[model samples]
Target: MLFIQNIYLNKFLIFSSIIYLIYLNNCVYSIFECAPQETATFVRISRARLDGTPLVVSTAGHDLTCSQYCRNNIEPTTGAQRLCASFNFDGRETCYFFDDAAAPSAGQAELNPNPSANNFYYEKTCLPAVNAHEACTYRSFSFERIRKTSLEGFVKKSIQVASREQCLSACLKEKEFICRSVNYNYDTYACEMSIEDRRSKPTHLRMTVDQPVDYFDNNCLNRQNRCSQQGGNLVFVKTTQFEIKYYDHTQSVEPQESNCLQKCLDSLNTFCRSVEFSPNEKNCIVSDEDTFSRADQQGAVQNKDYYEPICVSADLSSSTCRQQAAFNRFIGVSIEGQPVATAQGVTIADCVSLCFQNLNCKSLNFDRTQSTCHIFAVGQANANVKKNPSVDFYEFNCESQFGGMALCTNEGIRFIVNTKEPYTGAIYAAEKFSTCSQVVENAKQISITFPPPNISPNCGTTIKV
Candidate 1:
């Protein structure tokens, strides 16, 4: 019995010695692993806060305290933005920074005077192998809200969500249908995904959706070139039905609408003038030849979808695409459309392009807020030209090309014409028509831009897009 007791005592002593040796060698650590990564939210929160605004960021690094991490890392360029690191989910944390036109958002971001030790573990996130921005740029996300929106149709699919961030994760992971827009319902935590072809539909900015739901654009749109697609490459035209007035059908029975359009575009014999799709039998009619004149769309199925590559270059928003300013200075009044060649979302450059593209366009009205381009026939003279508050009427001001009008105008100056971009001073010229025109002749395409206003006449003169 004594020998057995000694053996047991010796084994216990050996174990204690080994542990002490390991401790002396600094091989042990006191640490807490992350409980578990939760979902992440995609809000465009502003950094400017009156008080206690929280910033949520994902960070990770070994032996990193929040204060040390910020000082050693992301400090110089961004300033003392690293206020406090609070865990949200998906390794995201809340930090503070100054704010942007299209900046993202944060919720429950406002910091608390004292965060409970139980609810949050105040530890820095694990750092990526590379820097934060580089890794973040490589990441993709969806624009789902803790809030929600709904529609009977146009929804590609739906996903279950634990939080607003989780729904965004699912939407980002979607494989099919270019997911540009998402509607989130706060009550049900349902995220409805939508793939909108802005070519046929409207940008979410213009879409008047109801409440209890919020709309997010293709997360890429917020980051100019992130997604390869947002605004399309080709010029946009209205969906209409057309009947080939002169050409004979190559196929006795019309082919599918898509096939027909492709056949025309691919035809070696002739350039596809315009495409007319018939929904009744799902047929398409391709024009045999191109018509550079205004009469091309004279008499067709006005009720269905029509598409034409009418621009000098199909790259409508390309920076290198040059445009000419049609009017010198027509302030406040509008020139009507070319009987038929009316277009919405027209910039000054686009206005010039509209007139230059259609042989029939004699005059045009470019609205600042509406971004609309109205091309009209020259024959329709301004016989009874009246002053109107809604538009900037463009007319030839060849006599007094005084660069641009000032705060005051001459008595004969029925309309004030601006040859450049619009500014606050332009608003002062109330009595005169603000004939606004963009310098499209040497229009340089600039890719960087803020999201435009949601109203009509959606195009601005400064940048072509």
Candidate 2:
């Protein structure tokens, strides 16, 4: 028995020594260095008091404490006691454990303060490998709300690139560039990159504001200089034009094409002339004219399609001659099949005003016969009126007729009379019409002098003195 005891003691010593050495190397004192079970549970108590004051018991960082304490002694009521025992602290507040299971109600006291009293509840979650010596803690994070008006400065720049991808890349490389939210095609494509002024942040401003900024430069050249070399050689291209009409009005910028149109359509006082999209960047060249042009050649690339331009014409009568046979009349040109709107009850001035207020109205056609108004919603309506018909009126939508007025007519006619060689005669109607030699002679030579009141119906035939 003694020999067996000695052998057992020796074996035990050797095992203990091995464990001690392993523990010293790994810096572990517990029998099992396993991670704690992830869990979500509440710690509940009844009638918690501090300094004789009724206190509200709360859980914070794996510990239970009183949130509200009084300086004087106060007994907790039954209701307060119930609330204290029913309140629950989310497992996330205590440890890294996430609440994967259904949360318990405050009424369920048994489930509120888990019988196990473990701050953590077991839950399945992905665990990233962590360095043994590093401490684990929650990271502080935040989010920012961005808007269009907040990024006007970065968008106003003239961005030039060989392709849309290059344009996007350039914006990404800019220091203050946040993202491209709005792009206006002013003959050339303008891209707006949004960026927050992080210099306002204390950390960034203190660090460095003059750091070398980086940006991508395509130099407006493609992989090959075919476009520059060709020099306006009828490249089958599509283009876009942006017109800023009203900046603060509901119909300011109007997008005529693409889903990106919605951005301008919803903005105040923004209007876009047209958009031209192509599969190849070499197909189109940005120009100074606010117009989009396309080549006649078809199928230069696959899926390359062009949309017709959306023309806006405010009023047409102001640019045409107005005559009155019975009712007010005006003769204006139309774009062949473009539709027009006409007003009759109102004078030509009022008619034009109405046309300007309508969203879809492009032109006007006023009929003198019935004194009626006709508003053409689309610009593709047929208008073929001839001979200045008494019932027919026409107007054309000029490109420059956006949110402005144009001169239609002037109220005078010039006439010259020549009596002999080296002699000329001119008459100023304003001063001579009332007391001219022809008027006085015609009055004296009249056959019968008619009463002034009777000249209403027979003014031409009857002379009035």
Candidate 3:
């Protein structure tokens, strides 16, 4: 116990020393402004390989598990379990963890676990939780039709999910087609996505009443950065410092005010319309309803703050004076630069604002540990760039002439002259390409089929291979 105490004491001393040094020098503080704790997902299965047999599948949280259980334990969400190895495909990165048990029940009666497949496959997903804008956009649902149905568009093939919430989340993660609406069937557990004509007039979507089915519209779904702050700063009121008549409902425990708001917004059980936080007590009280007529729980108030979240009203979303790239930050990615200049005694937002204000500063890194803001002149978007856990990277959301659009170049591409598809970039480019680049591994090339550019110089452009 003494040895353990000493070890902990040493660690604390070292950490405190670093923080003290940073504070004394007015250097960058290595603390993240936002806590984007994503829900980690992983699967535990019965076999090592996909052999046209039913695999016994189980799921465990990223936080609760044995290290050996996960095949790809390096990531927060990964698993393998006792006998199986999680195999990741080369180009697709699909998870295949298992070997055929080949018991007497291999092909006998129907398989216990239904989502059986001959090949290993997993769907890639993109969530709107990456930033504030995406969260705001995806959650802005115009209408939810209970017991309503849409007979148009494709029904998701393969495994049937459990709940409507799960169905909605799955739709949000779709990389292709913008999922405008979803119809969840309780009986079949079928989750169907639609981007059809009904999506045009979402409010006017034709509905056939089906008791077991529920349809929901993605109101502000893909509208990214549709509103600007217009120099209107959000007000954060410190009410806990003074005693007031208090509301009683306790939402959840959070470290900071932002965490409380984020938790409130993302909650599934109850809608969190407002938040009241106590800095001294470290307790967060959330209101599920918008109305504040009832202060159900009161008294014994000690240094708590009440936060009304309607500062940046949704009215700004539809406002015509919205700035295209006013204030935006991609959470996980960091912009690269050598840091031509550095400063101190500023917040991460201030650092971002500094970069946004400068025409020359393309990308910048705000050192959280050192408390220093470093500016960069040029930093192009490179998805393959490695991320440092300690640094907070900010890039100015400049309206790209090409809209930050680039084709992803990958292995095993055959097309050369693509005229029909307006834009066909690489699905996943391993390395950067210069000019209309294509796959040419060694001396051999994809079977070339020559074609001419249509419509004289053509309205847009075409690739000739």
Which of the numbered candidates is closest to the native, going by highest TM-score?
A: 1
Put the candidates in lDDT order, highest first. 3, 1, 2
> Under the 3 Å rule for N, CA and C atoms, how many clashes does model 1 have?
55
- Quality of model 3 by C-alpha lDDT: 0.40
TM-scores vs. true structure, each candidate = 0.35, 0.15, 0.23
- Give the TM-score ranking, best first: 1, 3, 2
Worst 10 residues of 2 by lDDT: 134-143
lDDT of 3 by residue, 64-174 (tens): 122123222233243332332232211112333332222221211222344322222221111323332333322212223333556454443323787544576665555
Kindly give the stretch of ten consecutive residues in candidate 3 with the minimal lDDT sum: 26-35
lDDT of 1 by residue, 138-193 (tens): 22222212123333357788887755445554545555655656766666788777
Query: lDDT scores for all predictions?
Result: 0.39, 0.28, 0.40
lDDT of 1 at 294: 23
Model 3 stretches astray by more than 4 angstroms: 1-181, 184-191, 195-250, 253-255, 262-465
How many residue pairs clash (N, CA or C atoms closer than 3 angstroms) in each of the candidate models, in the order given?
55, 33, 26
Off by over 4 Å in 2: 1-257, 263-274, 278-289, 292-465
